[model samples]
Target: MLGSLFQKFKDGLRKNTPTFQKFFGKVGGLFAAKLDAATIDELEEALFAADFGVETTEEILGEIRAAYRNNKDLRGQDAAKIGATVLSRVLEGAEGQFSPNPEHHPEVIALIGVNGAGKTTTAAKLAWRLQQEGQKVILGACDTFRAAANAQINTWAERLNVEIVSSQHGADSAAVAYDTLQAAKSRGYNVAILDTAGRLHTKGHLLEELKKLGRVVQKLDTSAPHHRWLVVDGSLGSNSIEQARVFHESFGLTGLVITKLDGTSRGGALVGIYRSLKLPVYFVGLGEKPEDLQPFSTTAYVEALFG
Candidate 1:
């Protein structure tokens, strides 16, 4: 399963890989040759160009420098091996598995992100994925603020053949969330995925509204809203890290769904976002299809990155 998924991820990431591979190719000669300051500077620039955030890039460079000092005979591939090891270690703390607790009937997952982050589509895809696993799923169109947010979610519900609870335009979003959960409990759905309005992290009022939505869910069931997942645009590069930080602070985000990895060369940005936030990535959107959203696997991701 992971092999096929990794292949798909690799295919989607092909455009980004050349940039990443360039670093290895440039420094491949250095492994057999003596390491010098110039080579290290070039490696740093390559990593930055690959979108590895400064902190993570520095950490990897430090490790390589230390290893080079210890043994000048290291081959470029060996350095690549070392780099992968260091990156895996940096990502280990953020690794986590997301599985719905069977005991928590109607497991609630609220998707949050800024406009164009693909939150609504992710919600639909997530619901479809869960449904395929034989779990009854429902969607909540709680994005009352966006003009056609409800209509978009309703369309997905029809396409996916899942039930949805939504209110009219200009309605209170918190009320929609509260009613969605109430309906989920009464209707015996296995999971309730709420699609919230896309709000910029810099918007304080909108952030407060997100908190209100969470509060309404908790009021129904303390253990409700079991997962708060932030959907981020993978193409945003280092900027995505700031977005994750702000959303995590506002909602205590439990997981992340990175979207649009197929279209950008900034796939390396995942490293920075995970390293900075320390939040597990639950899913990655590889394409527009429902089946394209694959569960996050650390081993597969690292292998694809360094392959």
Candidate 2:
């Protein structure tokens, strides 16, 4: 069902990545002619319009100017080629994958985010991906305070044929987390994916609830809840970076998962977030399905974005 659909979405992401097309459009015609003052001005507006942020745009363009100066013969499409290489170079090493060591088998990854950040869906996607890798996974529905938290995860649990440790609505979420870890440990699940409450960092009580769950998990296994993933909606643009900064302060995030890449024009925020946070981007969600999640790859991402 979703598995097959997600495969298509991931394929489409690579084929029609927004970043690649944006860059190609901006530098395409300008660099199609010999390098000149006019072309450089056009390129400047393009970088700013692309939402690369002022500093980043300046940094990339500065590199391009240096490259052009060194090689006076570079013109036309070749000029654009050098410019693209410059952008890719600045974006190098930003791609990465989120992989928890099995040494902490039955490792716990606490997925944290505000509501609508695709927290529930990401958890399901991650569990499915881990299962495909031959790891036994258990899900913990610790978002009991939400109306649909348990139901959302239950749908995924059924689809994945995995066990879920959950309690009735309004139950103490930390208690559910405590029990889930115990159950996962006893059952020998290689990974425990904990679906925590989705609350904005500014929400005092809810943020504390997330901390309580983390504390409970740690009591069970000092390093349990080994990784904390902050899921951000890609469309938020500049606001997304602020969210990451806020959440990171509150949760001590270990990684990030930006969702809804297929629907947003501000995909440029991906670059902004990376430059600002410098944290590991464990995965990104392209659609609603479980398999739409993918590990971060800076080179492939920039290539896809500019195409």
Q: What TM-score does structure 2 among the candidates reach?
A: 0.84
Candidates' lDDT values, in order? 0.81, 0.73
**Model 2: worst 10 consecutive residues (lDDT sum):** 14-23
Model 2: per-residue Cα lDDT at residue 219: 88
- Which candidate ranks first by TM-score, i.e. highest? 1
For candidate 2, write residues 48-131 as lDDT tens digits: 555567777777677667877887655545544655576577656565555557688578988888788888888888889888
**How close is every model to the real structure, measured as TM-score?**
0.89, 0.84
lDDT of 1 by residue, 1-307 (tens): 6657666555555455554555454444443455466767777776787687888888888888888788776555666677789788888856567667888767899999998999999999999998999888888899998768889989988998989999999899989989888887898987999999886345897799899998889898888789999999988877878878888997899889988876666777898888888888899888888887888877887777665
